[model samples]
Target: MNNSLTNRLGELAKLFFKMGVISFGGPAAHIAMMEDEVVKRRQWLTSEHFLDLIGATNLIPGPSSTEMAIHVGYIYAGWVGLIVAGASFILPAALITGGFAWVYVTYGTLPQVAPLLYGIKPAVLAVILNALWRLGKKAVKTSKLLVIALGVAALVLLLNVNEAIALLIGGLLGMFWLHFPAKRNSPEDNTNLLIAGLTTGATLKATAAVGASAATASAANVSLWQLGLFFLKIGSILFGGGYVLVAFLQGGLVEEYGWLTQQQLLDAIAIGQFTPGPVLSTATFIGYIIAGVPGAIVATVGIFLPSFFFVAALNPLVPRLRASKWTAAFLDAVNVSSVALMAVVTLQLGAATLLVAKAPYVDFVALAIALLSAVLAIRFNINAAWLVLGGALIGWLFFTLGLYPIK
Candidate 1:
């Protein structure tokens, strides 16, 4: 490479690496930092073009912040910058989470650590609930979209349908129901159309769910290749943000394969929130638990690989994508469905974290932590990372003082 090109790539690497280390609070915070450094400070791209990139990332699947990093790198340093920027941004979080995974695997069962996790897990639910509320307001704009969200929720929450399948059903149904001109003159006709659409989608979800159930294998003998493939599929189809990932993991890992217990999944999410950069770093923690260092490596690469491909492919089509109504309709449906799925996962996690199997049947302290966390997050607009840390500190203090009993 020329000296100028090499220098530019190096600059890209340094900037993104720094952001990766400090970019906490999830995708929104990550993007705000990028905007400041890349646009306001560095003058790397104009605000208009940066907004276009954001829209493009939304059009495609993957973490929007990570994709934005890749997009900026591509603009500044070409294909190599794409790799460098993405890896730079991901490396810090992956490494940090990997270290935590090692510690968790080694000492998670100890009394001291258990209480810390006790608080963090419920706080994670609050975080996910916050994301669900924010995304739901934006995605569910129309009554038709509301019907779509409810339908997708029913499929996943009640029928035990696969999340990916439910998402596809929602998107396709939305494209047809929202985009196409229908001959519905009255409220009765509109209601009938929505009912028919939900019925058709449910039928499809049921059929897919049956096949999906039969195909799931136990993860007791999971191979690295299988692990990589699972995450790759997740990366390709994941919409909304990192919070949406719980739906996919809850179904595939916890229920289908039994690779992780509900508690383990909640712990993984808490670790992800505790770290910086993309929340998908939870993959690194999860991979380590399932298969050690090799698993962590494969899982991280597999889950992040799709984002690079998506950003590259979608970057060129941003203008066209932003103009198409059909694309907008499809994205709206998929987004609402993703939010709906997140809502279901949040409820499930709440039950897992706030309710005990014996005696009291409820952990009132955990419930109080969750309520406080939610108020701080929604009403007070506190950062999620702070809430997580606050929960950890409170749990540790409560346990140390003999106030909160250890389960």
Candidate 2:
């Protein structure tokens, strides 16, 4: 690579590493951070290019922000740059989260941190809603696309279908709809052409089924090698984003391996959500809880190694991947599916905090503050960090005024 390119790559790595350490909240927040750094701050790519990367990553089966980082790295430099960028972006959060995981596992629970997250969770909900509004406007360009998104959301929430499956089905619908126009007289011909094309191409791949089965099999046969392999497979095959990882992790580690109890798994997830970086950092927590530091290393590596490999392997083919009309259509469908899935996750989280969980009633003042923050986010385009800070202040108010218990 050229000297200039090398320097740029190094700079990207350093910046992303810093982001990985401190960029908490979840994928939405991570994406916002990436946009701020790479697009607005760095001016490495135009806003349009950044949005395209987001759409592309949403279509693929991995962490969207991480893949975006890889895409930016590749765009700025080359293949080596991609590696350096992804590693730099991922490592900080991995290490910091791993350390926190170690502490949590070793100590039994994170009582103080829990309240911080309790406050954070409500903000997370608002953040997600704002993202949904923005992404929905951008992604659902046609009526058919909106229908596909709604249908996918219903199927997932009502039928309890696997998210991967929903994504594939949406993609296939998009592909077919995009590529093959229905006869003019056909009843479905009224559907938006682009949405139809995208969904048709998004049909689930046979490989995905095979990959999931292998993961299950590996988890069933418990060995250190098997454990690593199971998570490796999960990380490799998992698409959508961090919430998807939660389902896979709970199933593989808690249900399949019995490595940790459901409560412990929930706690790990809670910590990951509250802390910075990707939810996959929960792996570090799981690793430490299961077998201490070494296990943490193995699990952390096992989970992320797949993302590294998949992005690297796919980098060469990205052009071709984008070229296929069917593939593009499928990606369109997948984006809808991903957003639909996020909607479900958002609702579930809201239900947990508002209804199912044993949290205190929402203080009207706090809710009003949160609503105002959400309005600012939607109307004035405020940053999430500012909103989160605002929420924290409101939380402090509640605590000080004896409106809510500190715990």
Candidate 3:
């Protein structure tokens, strides 16, 4: 109601709208873009506050960047801003992906985006690596914490423990081990205790194979509600990032329900990675395949709906998370854990961009571009968007010159 609040809301809308349109390269780039906007440019919040949002997002199960949008919205203007900011940020990607889905269904195959991704993927990896280094300085404050981070990376990469489970373990250990004595009367202290007590206390299914049985035929008959609920479940409990959705959709949609073929599923993922906004909109593409326009709308909403609630529930406690010694330690552990997971995923994505498995997939040009993007990002301090665009331009140029095929 207040004019000052109204102006801040406008700021949120304007910035997030632009970000929604250009928030390419994926989560790391999105986060970096947000940091540059909210933390560095507008001075709406501190770098510490921004980092806390990032860490808190890791605590939840939704898209981290989208949740952060909701959380930041709450930070600025409570519930109204939360809805507006998230919607503003997600609209562009959903619409673009919806168009792509329409095309794929009309044609048997998705359009080739190999050239665009050829450059974007490596830049994305580099952006994440840059972010990891920057956040690590703040998150890794002690040797014990450093060990916790390394331990998490080991558990995840070597033993293949679930990332959510790893985060839980770190938080629990930090709750006990990181506990420190403090007075109760200070409002800040009370806030921290309430947050540490309540926040830290919040500690939080596979498909079957396709069959020739009658069940197989029946499974293909998915309704709109079934489609929505299906993606809703995936959005709620999904961990390990959007990449993990690959295995999930393959199993559930292709194997269990037989609603999607493996090729369709792969095409959906390609659309997701190639487009902007939440990568989970792959659910939208999958939904359209099962139902229609209504299916796409429902599935998109289902996949992203949980994120708003999670952010609303968790955002208020962030200040407390920053203030309490106990919660702070828990967050520290969580941040380090996040960095570890991020590093592992970045490496995997970077390797993928190399495209060196065999002919057709193999591209020495992509490899060189990736390395160049890394160098430009690291040594020159170029904005990630520029690096991504530069990569795209060069990739298109090479294809145009007839040096390498665009797949």
TM-score of each: 0.60, 0.75, 0.84
Sort order, TM-score high to low: 3, 2, 1
> Which window of 10 residues has the lowest lDDT sum in candidate 2?
198-207
What does the lDDT read for residue 226 in candidate 2?
Answer: 60
Clashes of 3: 0
Clashing pairs in 1: none
True lDDT of residue 171, candidate 3: 64
Give the winner by lDDT.
Answer: 1
Candidate 3 lDDT (Cα, whole model)?
A: 0.74
Cα lDDT for residue 43, model 1? 85
lDDT per residue for candidate 1 within 128-228, as digits (tens), equals: 67656645666678899899989999998899876656777787788778888555335643544453344335434433332133345555678888899
Better of 2 and 3 by lDDT: 3
Tens-digit lDDT string for candidate 2 (221-251): 4455665776677676666556667777776
lDDT of 1: 0.76
Q: Model 3: per-residue lDDT, tens digit, 298-393?
A: 999999998998888888778767676767777777777777777766666666666676666656777777777778867776766677678778
